[model samples]
Target chain A: MRTMRLNMQNVCLTMVLSLIALGGCDRQATVSTTSVGAASGAPDAAPARKLRIGVSIPAADHGWTAGVNWWAKHASQLYPNVDWSIVSALNPEKQVADIEDLMVKGVDGLVILATESAPLTPVARKAHERGVFIVNVDRGFLEPVADIFIEGDNKAFGRKSAEFIVEKLGGKGSVAILEGIPCTVNTDRVEAAMAVFARHPEIKVLGRQPAMWNRQKALEVTENMLQQYPKIDCLWASDDDMALGAMQAVKEAGRDKEMFIFPGAGMKDVVKMVMDKDPLIPANITYPPSMIATGMHLCVSVLSGEREKIMQYMPRHLMIDVELITPENAKQYYFPDSIY
Target chain B: MRQASTRVLSLTAGGWAPAAALILVITLGFVFHGDRAYFNWNTHRDAMRQASVYGILACGMTAVILAGGIDLSVGSVLALVSVAFSMMSLHRQDSAAMTIPAALMIGAACGGVSGALIAFGRIQPFIVTLAMMVAARGLAKALCGGVKVSRYIQDADGRYIALPVPEAFSRIDARLLGGNIAVVTVIFLACVLVCHVALTRTTWGRRVYALGGNEEASRLSGVPTRMMKVSVYALSGACAAVAGICQAAQLQQGDPEDGAGYELSAIAMVVIGGTRLSGGRGGIGLTLIGVLIVGYIEKILSINNVPEYARLMFTGAIILAAVLLQRRWHPDSEGRG
Candidate 1:
């Protein structure tokens, strides 16, 4: 009886080793087959149902875009099951191609920051047609393709900046305008400022020029304008970096006494200047780069079955409030540690 | 009298002509806008100062062009060097002496890689540098983790801290002579001088010109063509790196995306400087002129209240005009081809 039991045990051990070897082979085959299947569009039987999210954004060619990229990456890390892919292109045509590529990759949802309105509307519409959830960030699209549109109220930004200048100059001072990139945000800001400036005809606009969101360009432009308008009371810049350049020019020209510069965008540097009550930079408008986080939140909500609460039938345009960053509230906007 | 008159005209034609033209335009601009205060010494100085960084990069680019090669990676190299320098400076706050050299070395190393690929790997300068541009930018962005790394001050206890420098350098920057001139401006001028000497006075310089003028002949003449090609790119890389470090120091931060689209500007400056894009000709002096022209036009436009879009259009037009002039001057050299 003992000899028979020893033989049986040896047979059992051999069977177990063969099973382990077969299992190893099975895993290798599975990996290669899955890769091949993905390439050939074979339907996966126990498909890993990943919640794929597409992030469409402008190229990180500037500070704001850099911030957007940072926030998007941060948001992606917070969700594990969701596969996040980022595609950044500077122009509308490239952006559209990126969107189409994402669609082919079979994403469940998308987060878009359009480079322009009309050029991106069709792209958003196409994504919506394919029943993909869409969340628009910053710049808006013309068509009602987005389930949620998140952006700052640029008009308010303009009005607030203008109001500060009018109040500071006692509603009667010569001011020059430094416009941002030509877009809806720029147009809205200009229109809003115009509305306020129209009320106070005494506040003469010495010269309005576009700084193109470049510091050196702003410096040169401001210097030239300063030369042209020697008696200027204040300078209104659409962005903080440009305002910084303008202030530098004024200081360099020894005309600090004749100029007060207020730039928008509430960049950390500008907020710091406001907090310190820098004479040349007394006030600025707040438009945070973190609105990208809101778009990501909406996108996640839709993918995670909170779709009804997040999605609206009409294009849901969200206008984030802009705070006029002066000495009083500058501390609130001052993030010394923030990258922006 | 006739000979003296021709000499005066040639002198003016070479340098003073463009300078005079720029001055005349500013004067005309001032006269046209009678009540406007656009033409002044300070404005001109500020414009030139702003253009100095681009000027330095273009000076290096002119050398590369003269050697019958192109470097699209200069801008990316600049961004990387700037980021590397800023990070090092912040990390090793106690070792201030090592910061500048270390930053320069990092730039040289990056440039050396591009040189190796072009010279030894038998890669086309355009393709190699293009890849370097994309890769360097990716590396820079990755180094910062795709965020703007702001200037931070270290505490006495050797901890990182935030300190805004908007006013920190104002007093220093304001001073003349003993005052802190923007290191960038000084470095730019120094680079121009050094490049001038290297191109005109050195044996290596002769080889660079010979190679650009005729690579096959240079090879046959035993000029060590491969080494020369590598050295030229490495030099361009080093210059870019210096520019990057200057940009970071001035901005008080290392921005991963700071030098975006700057390679084109650098190339434009070189091309406009009357450097034959086909290579083997042109000098740094012409690059300075090109830089001045670009800087002045931009300054003048902004001073006149031109919109941002218009400014871009204007810059494009000026670049086109400069290129046209270059082509007209060198009909046999199809630089674009």
Candidate 2:
């Protein structure tokens, strides 16, 4: 027993030293899935006269993208004269392949929301060079190749959320942050939020961890955060699904009434919390999945006969507003008919 | 005396290398980021909860690998089963009764086809499962009509707010044991128990190991090799189905996207457990250790709040280090899966 104990101690010392030198623990994960092609809307209709519009986006793997699908189909119905082909890609390779297929099928306009910026950029650029009217939504291409770019202001979403937390906490308190997946978009949101928190020296960030953009992951990560910090005043869950997960963890820890949570995205359930004025969730940030509809509508407007007037009036870069969902404006954002 | 001493020394140093590494890494974790959060009972309990899915999958994978075969279709089966469980149920959507059996069947059916192709049709296990992987995931997407199942959570008012999920279907993960231990952990333990017993005790267990060690020799010696191969793959499929069910329970919905790359994790666990991918060595108990190792590593880093990008690199490095150390103890085997 003594020998074993001695061995364990020696090993433990080496392990700790090695760990520190190595920088930290390793906890990474899965590759982005290869998306398959799925089509919505009818095939060619009056091919000669109608404007052919191809919509490409990521498959609805989570709550947010499901809303994208709902809006895409909804907008497809608005213009019967247009030939709409909405394709959802699962991975970068499949996305590139699907877009190539779309270009071959002869679309006059292509609206793409890339899965990853790097792979989709060149292919989208090729589509653009070929005179395709490119309308990029949510995720953008590497170059400014799109005729129009439309998205929720993620950085603003992050900044405004942190700003609200600062204002609510009177600019001083301990906060735990739950980040989504480690991506450029997620980084932009987090860094912007951190910048807001940085300006206020009084607000200390107790813990900030990636929740992998999933509800279950958020629950587990937040549980760890709760154990680490006993006196957390507020939690910036960043995303609604994450907020819901964190809220559950806090409640499971039986500190629901004590802790304040701010989860973004106008996910219906979280929106309902704002509508009901749930004590734990005082407010939320808006990053609606409905931006796809806005993109689709804009593409139609740009391609319509009034193109000269529309181009003069509408800007090439369009940032949809990020609203704070308090009890007052919660009703407008609540869409019962929408999937997400 | 010298031989015995070396046996003891090697057992301590090499046989338990993964365990030693696990403890060492965890201790380092506490040293770097330890506090109430890093060293608590709930943290350990949640660690087990997190490991549960891979624990379940790895247990069955140990058997499949011991039979000198690999099954890559586990992830696809997980996707299929989770989607089918949600889409197949005629009654209440989240009803455990309707969901569990249907998931298992779908998993088994996917496995059965792959097994048949590999065992009887004489295709490579890798090829068979690779095809099954894409086909199964495709079917899952088709079944869900390519939309995420919405799930829900309750508010302070005790009012139910639905999140459009067929994703809301998971309520199983919410069940707790004394408010600390997750029911998911219990499910994982039960699977480990059954797999461990069946792998170590039964005549079939011996056959599985023997076939993996030497299929031609085992077959000539009256072991039913072909039947065993099919059974192992089927068992793997069924195990994956259980994992899918648990994931749905935990996530509270059927995610067609769930378990997308989880098979690699399971295979990693089984391989780390000192199970020779070339077959003929290792057991389910070893896999449990691997699952715990990976689980604890994930938990430790998460609690420590390590920079997210660094997490993957550290995980890969340690997995490499531990496996390399384990390989030196067994000079001949590739020690890979």
Candidate 3:
């Protein structure tokens, strides 16, 4: 009882302290503090002097985003003249604040992989309006609010993988898709694949389930699918980890001889299997997570005078082609140093 | 003795509602699809296996709720524990002994800190646990340096194999009793039974109800209210860690994002089991039925090849109906809530 009063008093005190703390921290905190290149805080600067590039990306919560963070850092070292402040925010609100902070700090250019496309468009547009060169990666804004847009084609990835499966089955077979949860991006992949399958009169369209993009859930879904379909000719094991999962279930049930799985996003091990010509491991589609590195490199290049003038004819919207890697060309796509 | 008997009768009465609903769903599926593949042992077992993690975490959440506390940090704890276990396994090739204890300890320590703040620091459980939730996830990200820990796995023959290959650690979520029941399900049931005993037949159990019923009254009556509050959270933390270990074994990867948003499902189980949100009421027997209800619904939907969004909508509808039914039946507790 004595503690309750003390607790109430402490609660009030803590609330007050936190308000003061939040007030003190309204300026925001960022990962990289030291600004390299010219002190752009001053108006005048030399043409050869380096400019500040701000990279705002989603935090490394999973394998892919971690790869993005890794590449962002790696891109910094490659461009010694330019200053890069790579800040990863956990959510969209933090990301918005991050962009505002970068704006306040007067970054010459901005590179962003939006936490989500729509909510981030306004801030991105603001940066573009302020004469800050904007490079959008992976997720594109609703409006053409950037100087350059770079992304792997989700639709192409779906269409090509579906085409490979149909070709392997000689245009007629039972195929089931193990979807990576129902997100806008994954749905694009599945719907495009389904559209292609719909064109083939010989192909039978079985049902699909969301594997939640986790290995264990995919394993369970695959195990259940195996039971439901006695003869599953091909599986769209779309994610690399999901492919690994579905493969495990097939191998355990000794059904590897009958079916092949196509996992995407080119994780190192999966690519290695395709390279070694593992019988069950047929091929994978390449949608590299290192697009952030590409975005970073471009941000530095376009901000510089030489590369921008030389590559003036380059389109503002660049879709990095997604490829299907078989044993023949698997070596070309494999990045042994990739985190994914 | 007489009080205990009436409580048993009340619990039995509460159990019949969800149990009957479950039976109705299973029988309806069979009745409707008599000829088609509307049923299978493997699918049912898979649902049970998947539900085991929820069951274990729900049992722990029940204890905390009964003591007038809520734990929003279980999911983060699960993620943290998973990384801790995998990181340990990396150091010691055969890490079942070391990893299991280390993971559990990390979970308990994290929860203990939250519990201590709520008890001694006089902060609200919601705020304290919420802080812990964010901090624990950040800690998990930091522990693995924000990457999946892919150390090589050692097979049964003492040969080292790469991580993509399923190894002995996968045995944690493997089936027992000739592939009928999963190891996760077994641990879940064991935890449920033990917690059922601890929350019912002990003096501490009585103290739990007293504290939740009226904190001031309980403290005035010489109840060690602070310790009970702290220990319940500790127990919840340990149970979440156990679920994490089972998850790590099942996935064969130390995913930092493992068990994300699992706390909501676990809490849903507790509430759908006829547990009052106001606390001081509910037991594990009814919770078992709640677990089965959710499991059977998901399995039936997936087996029927229902779309993912529709499956989620149905689950939400069924759980909401179950809660409404409980409130309708126990009209007297409605005011208390």
lDDT of 3 by residue, B144-263 (tens): 887665444346874434543234455775688776777888889998998888878898887877777678988998999888888889989999898888766655456676677788
TM-score of predicted structure 1, chain A: 0.81
Off by over 4 Å in 3: A1-340, B1-6, B32-38, B151-168, B334-337
Position B148, candidate 1: lDDT = 57
Please give the range of 10 consecutive residues that has the lowest summed lDDT in model 3 chain B.
B31-40
Give the lowest summed-lDDT range of ten residues in model 1 chain A. A33-42
Better of 1 and 2 by lDDT: 2
Q: Deviation in angstroms for A299 in model 1?
A: 40
Give the TM-scores of the predictions, in the order they appear. 0.48, 0.51, 0.51
Q: What is model 3's DockQ versus the real complex?
A: 0.01
lDDT of 1 by residue, B86-186 (tens): 67765445243676677677777777788788889999999999999999999999998765555443367744455533332222123244422444566
Best of the candidates, DockQ? 2
**What value does the lDDT take at residue B252 in candidate 3?**
47
Label model 1 with its docking quality class: incorrect
For candidate 2 chain B, the 10 contiguous residues with the lowest summed lDDT are: B2-11
lDDT of 2 by residue, B1-337 (tens): 3223332332254447667656665675566442234555666776677788888888778888888889898887887777677554422555556567777887877888888888899899999999999998888889877544424334587443544434334345454757577777888899989987776668887788888888898889899877888888888999999988776554445567768778888988887766778887777767777898888776665553344346567666656655665556565668444
